[model samples]
Target: MGKKAAMQKSKQWNVKGAMRLTSVFHFLQSCGSGCLVPFLTLYFRHLGLTATMTGIIMASKHLLTLVWRPVSSILARQYDKRRTVIVGSLLSSALVVLILLLFPSAGTKAESGRCNASQPSADFTDGSDFTTLESMIIPSQSNVTVYSVNHTTVIMEQPDDLNSTYTPTLVNSSSNWSRRAIRYLRELKEQQEESLHTEFLGSLKAMDAQHQMFFLVLIVIGLWEFMAAPLEWTADDGLYEYLDFVDATDRHKGVTVWKPLGTAVGNGVVGILVTSLYCRTGTVAEFYSYTAFMILTVPTAALLPLYIRKRDRPTSGGFKALQLVHRNSQALLCAITVVLTGIASSAVSDFLLWHMQDHNATEIHMGISLALAHLSQAGFPLYAGHLAGFLKYHGWLLVLAVIALSIQCLYYSFLWDPWSIIPAQILAGFSTGALWWSVAAQCEDIATPGTEETLIRLFEGLPLELGSGLGSLMAGFVMQKFGIKILFQGISVILAVWSITLAALKWKIPRQRRINYSRLLTADTGEISESESDQEKDWLETAMEDDNQKNNWTIAKS
Candidate 1:
């Protein structure tokens, strides 16, 4: 009796630990997705990369995910989840840091100082000297060359000097893409610096801020794994991971489906923790802000599992389930948001170009937009969670909002001739909130009854990674190939189809589950306990269904 009681107590403790771990997982996931998606364009633009190259580079990450996420999922099942998470986080972190390292940052302090210095005085002995200096100093991104009388030229090397142009005669066409981009960006940067009052400066600042934010996100994910993975690995998985069927899927094959709601919650709490820390001390508040948003990642990663489960559910007075609902709905909404934003980006950039004489204004405008998008998106989940709580609607509101936003996109695309895409962009800002909510809610709903938590998280992420990858690439391609008008039209069409599909599937289940606030506690115990056999049975049944579904699937991998 004594041994049995002790075992029961242990089980309870494990459940609590699992719950806490899951929340942390969710926060990290959110931060991961939120920081990257809104700012990838800004990062590329800041690097002076053309839209096409930016799209390709962004697509590369998705391509990597297509290979990596599934492999990671398989490993998670076969090995310890904690270890899998840590490995994934660490590897992802290393890759991120490496990618950033590949790019130039503020540079070394000494280098920065030199770059910040003004151009050297030029000899005014001859008029030809001034012309030569203008030609040399205005073109090169790093080194400025000034020509005086008698073929005399002075070269100034300053890495940060926007006025310093390269030796025009020496800029070979054979130079690599990065060098060319860096040169171009520096030129753009110089242009912006000349005019600090224009809207363009804001945009540049927004982009710069976006790039910095992403770098920080990568760092935070690494830190999370460093701090939380070992404890999670050691924690009891009975109430969460074990309950979700760690053994059922073919480790080598098709998609692994499971809910990861707990992970999302964990991420949310982490965000809260960061907020709290910031409240306590202002230092590193931005880092705290970034870490706090970690919650968004879980839903996107586990989208497939959530959709599959959604597919299997009993219809409310049932019509045939809408095939390809997930793709159509999400794609449509996301496309609309991007297209509208693109148009706005163009119109605004153009307006700034025409009206603003200072480059600094352009930089600041871009920076503000980038920052606004991320900060708003970071707060999205909390608002969504609150809405879900009040309305008792899982993700219905988010979907509706997306649809509404798409309509607004159409309004900007069609009716508002001279208003700029600003109005549409204002609406487009809601896309992340809607999509993230949909992803998270879908995971909660569609994942098998008792196994919703694990699968939700697992499936939410992959889709976001994949979707954003495709979206960013497509956005860049469309923007580069066709003007913003065509891009807006394309996005409208995609979103229209998606909305129709969502209206068709239209499964509505009344919210009945009570919020288990106790689940938020970090202890190793919950309010209830169940036998090991029961937990095993729950997992086995879910896995069998999942396997059967996989056998029947014939569609392409999105």
Candidate 2:
């Protein structure tokens, strides 16, 4: 009996071990993805692809998610969640590896240096002297040496000694030829700057053979990602269900704390890896390394389902999920808010690397900025539930989120250097964390009957797909035409307007009590004992009466 009891206890502990394993899985996945995906645009640029093309590629992933999400849900319902997760992880990893193997070349460091050299200098203007342009274009410490000998300009490799002697050449000492040469050089410099700027804006001409290959690779990856979406959903649903079963408090902690904390740690780890890799091996090689790391670890998620208890699978249908959106006014409002926030946040996230590079940030600084943003993002959600309580209403949290977003945008617009953007991520992180947390609660409160998880997924996914896709598409065009600074300013203005609209709507709308399983099941289930039936009937009647009274009050006010 003692041995049996010990065995039972050991089995229980082993089952509980799934949670810790899942957390580690989340951290590793986040670290791998965070390192590569965020900097993909910069990698595209390195391959001579324009910003608009990069945006299109990135946007395609989200668009694919929009189409694939419902299918993924259905698959999860049809099969075991673990199998789906394993299949998705394997496919995604394979695709990443394939992409890495197909790349033609990581552009050489010298070529990248030339591209950097073409950028307009800080003091460069139409009226600036040619000497300034020359100084920038031909750095004194460069490996290539330039000298004039016997009326011919000879470019050669630099010798070890800076003071190496060279023959003198005389040019029309009596004429204005030097002035004409300077003018020509200045014109050439201007043209180079213009060409680089156009590339930055994502000109069509930038799509050479190599870039076209990358574009095709991205499309294929997007398809694989779409297919894998269901696996992620399955994993998330299983984890949540398990947490709800084992420890009710942990259900809340999973999203509000553990997930974000894991993400934070992942981001920090990835940031350091990205910096080290970028500095040593360049962007393309770094991506290959990232892919290898991801492929190695992603399969470990398959082991997770073996330990966790499986719950009854939820029914899934695309149309059924779609119908939930029209169930209530609050649901519609929540959808709109989520969509708007997605647009604002997606633009910031997709273009962050470009913005940092434009401001001349080094790999280390870029890593630090990303890590700090994620840390703040993780830390803020811990206080979100408390903040909602203090404000006496969850709606107020949305308002605060808007305020934080506006401040972040404003700060981004004014930033003159890369490091400055790091501190600004605090507001960005807080706004994102608070907004998502409140949105989840709001969606849960307004979920339709028999569609709680489905409605929540829709609420989370639709806006995420549409907003990020549209935001990236629009940002490419806007940044091309108006520049990065103006892009942020415009986003700020739009956010300000959105905040005002949200405030007005919040006051006009009425709040409702969240529907719980007990309330829903008790009301809907038939053939109960007479006393239980009577109790359920009484509860339903009271709820109807309250709803009627609230409706009448609203009508009278209107």
Q: Largest TM-score belongs to which candidate? A: 2
Q: Which regions of candidate 1 are displaced past 4 Å?
A: 1-18, 21-40, 84-88, 91-99, 102-239, 242-401, 407-466, 483-490, 496-558
For residues 1-558, could you state the per-residue lDDT of candidate 2 as single tens digits? 999999987765453576667666666656656656666667666665565766777678778878786666555655655555555664575465456435654333233443343544322323433221224343322344333333333344456776995443334523465445445555654565467555753443334445555566576668657655565566666666555455542442453344455445545555566556654555554455455555655656666633344555545433565655565556577678777777877778777677777777765666667777777777776677788899998877877788788778878888788788876876755687777777767756655544555666776788778988888888877877787788888888888898888888878876655544556576653322223344345566788899999999999999
Write one digit per residue (lDDT tens) for candidate 1, span 14-85.
533444444444445444433333333443454445555555565555445545554544444445353445
| Residue 305 displacement (Å), model 2 | 2.7
Q: What pairs collide in candidate 2?
A: none
